[model samples]
Target: MQFVILCKDKPDGLDLRMATRQVHLDYLKDVGGANLLGAGPFLDDQDRPTGSMLIVEFPSEAEARSFAQNDPYAKAGLFVDVEIRRWRWGVKPPAA
Candidate 1:
């Protein structure tokens, strides 16, 4: 199944997020296929990352939750809140 993980970072998280970005990227690389689409920082007028959004594929919600719980960003206390929702894919057909 596919899941969408929405994470909002705590205020003043930019520094920490930047500091840990490489490790977080490495972790994502290790779990690459699980992630279908991902992006970070909700962005503001200045176009800076304020939060994160991810869409991933997993066997179950438990698996999705586990991935979120073990994320380097999450472990580093980057997210003030994280929400996971099962996704229904294919609203729009892939471009041919």
Candidate 2:
């Protein structure tokens, strides 16, 4: 199933996020792999990242939760909140 991993950064987490960015990218590339459908950050009014959203596929919600928990950004305590939900691609689905 596909899941959406939504995360809100801590109020002062930009430095931490920037510091861990490359490792976070590596983790996503290494672990998420083909299961990663789409991912990016949520921008604030100043065009700075305030949170993240990732759409990923996994066998179960439990597995998806585990993946979210293991993200480098998560491990680094960059996020103040995280939410995981089953998702449906209702429009403009990716080409096969």
Candidate 3:
């Protein structure tokens, strides 16, 4: 099953986010990386990253929680809030 991880950064956390970005990317490149489908940061009104979202496949919610808990950003306490939910793939749109 696919899981969606939504995370909101702590206030004044941009520096931490920038510093830990590569480490987070590296985490996704390591073990349990295969489940990774896609990930991106959420932008604020000023176009600054304020949060992040990652979609990954996992056999259970336990695994999904582990993935989120182990992320570099999470380890560094960059997120103020994190939500994990099972995601169902929707019908794809036809080509234009």
> Which regions in candidate 1 have their CA more than 4 angstroms from the true location?
93-96
Candidates 2 and 3 compared: the better one by lDDT is 2
Tens digits of lDDT, candidate 1, 1-96 = 888899999999999999989988888778755455555558978988888887787889998899888889999999999999998767772343
The parts of candidate 3 lying over 4 Å away from their true place are: 93-96
lDDT of 3 by residue, 8-94 (tens): 999999999999999898898895567888889999999999999988889999999999999999999999999999997686722
Over 4 Å off, model 2 = none
Q: Among these predicted structures, which one has the highest TM-score?
A: 2
Task: Estimate the TM-score for candidate 3.
Answer: 0.91
Which pairs, if any, clash in model 1?
Answer: 41-50, 41-51, 42-51
| lDDT (Cα, tens digit) per residue for candidate 2, span 1-96 | 999999999998999999999999999999999999989999999989999999999999999999999999999999999999999999999997
Residue-level lDDT for 62 in candidate 3: 97
